[model samples]
Target: MKCLSMLAAALAVAGSVQAAEVQVAVAANFTAPMRKIAPMFEADTGHKAVLSFGSTGKFYTQIVNGAPFGVLLAADDATPARLEREGLGGSRFTYAVGRLVLWSRQAELVDAHGAVLKAGKFERLAVADPKLAPYGAAAYETLTKLGLLDTLRPKLVQGENIGQAYQFAATGNAQLGFVALSQVQADGKLKEGSAWIVPLSMHTPIRQDAILLAKAKDNKAAAAFMQYLRIDKVRAVMRAYGYEH
Candidate 1:
């Protein structure tokens, strides 16, 4: 309820901004929410948000290597702060928080509420590279807390980003993977799959941040889009996809 109310207020503010188009480099975990909000953002702002999705580490490398992105919505705060500190970004803001979930494509194979994990039937698990992706870190923390990290370590297959990690599970390349909850959510309900909502006890908070890249600070469209993202409606859309307010 608190999240919803706050989101409403934010969206209201976004609606008041004039429309323009901007280029956004986003983390793969934000795929679902960005898809949900893209049309609305374009319609309301009269600006199109051209997006490039990838791992935060990769994006950071690209930005440093001169990838042309006006704004960056990263999976964690540190990366964006680095951009600001390096003078690559004019301003940085934390727009939302994220949550991680364990998911499998096979619904019968998962018991989100049960100790299905204790059965240990799966041969492989997939996760983004913990050293590179925040979701992967959460997965590692969750397993460690459950006393399963040692047992699961050998079964782990790493992806460069959360999207690829989900692909590993969805394509059955891995029995399951650590993923963003939104991937399994559609229209406010969980999809046909077994999942475990790892307790927040497992990891550090995913404080995702948005930064105004030096290339975009003066771009009215990009700045507008960033402001639009701060609106409650946008945040609400993000929450619906399993992000924190």
Candidate 2:
């Protein structure tokens, strides 16, 4: 594949620069793209990104509780902004804009218009904990905008993070879920099942932000990783996973 070839080529470009690792706290919804980017990042920059993924809120709590994360890739802009305001972070920037989707592992369970929600055909619907994951909040906002929140509240199942919400649908624990589009799509196409790409108008934009944590202010690898996010190849990888700038 062209992408694999690119990654291999990038990895072959060994540098004379010293190598170091940076601990990164990443948002759960960004798991797929971040996994691909990490290897490419090491190959290109001679630095390894040690990644840990979870809900933005939980990661924030961990960061506040003395977690040694050098950088944070958050699911929402607010978390990074809050860190920067509190002097816990620096060099904050918007890395990606996430899209929400109503998805199901079954080929036709989810309709293009997402009418199935109002039809009440499914017994369960999964969403990440809105208090933790921005995608979950967007899901709730979508339901409220559609006037279906109260009607569907009884059937809602909550996950600690977007990854778990996606798992609930993938494993059939729920008939459907509100999840990040990146989880079910790749190379500009759906990897499996069916989904309704939730309209942006239904909720506020999910502006995923990245920041350099104060703890790693002097860490070269952390600084390099933040700068590396602006490269074309890196942006290209993000696009393949359904993220928008």
Highest-scoring model, TM-score: 2
lDDT of 2 by residue, 194-213 (tens): 99999999999999999999
In model 1, how large is the Cα lDDT of residue 140?
A: 86
How do the predictions measure up, each by TM-score? 0.89, 0.94
**Model 2, which residues run further than 4 Å from truth?**
1-15
Question: Model 1: clashing residue pairs?
Answer: 7-232, 10-231, 10-232, 11-231, 11-232, 11-233, 19-45, 20-47, 21-47, 21-48
lDDT score of residue 104 within candidate 1: 88
**Model 1 stretches astray by more than 4 angstroms:** 1-20
Measured with C-alpha atoms, the lDDT of residue 150 in candidate 2 is 99
Local accuracy by lDDT, each model: 0.82, 0.92
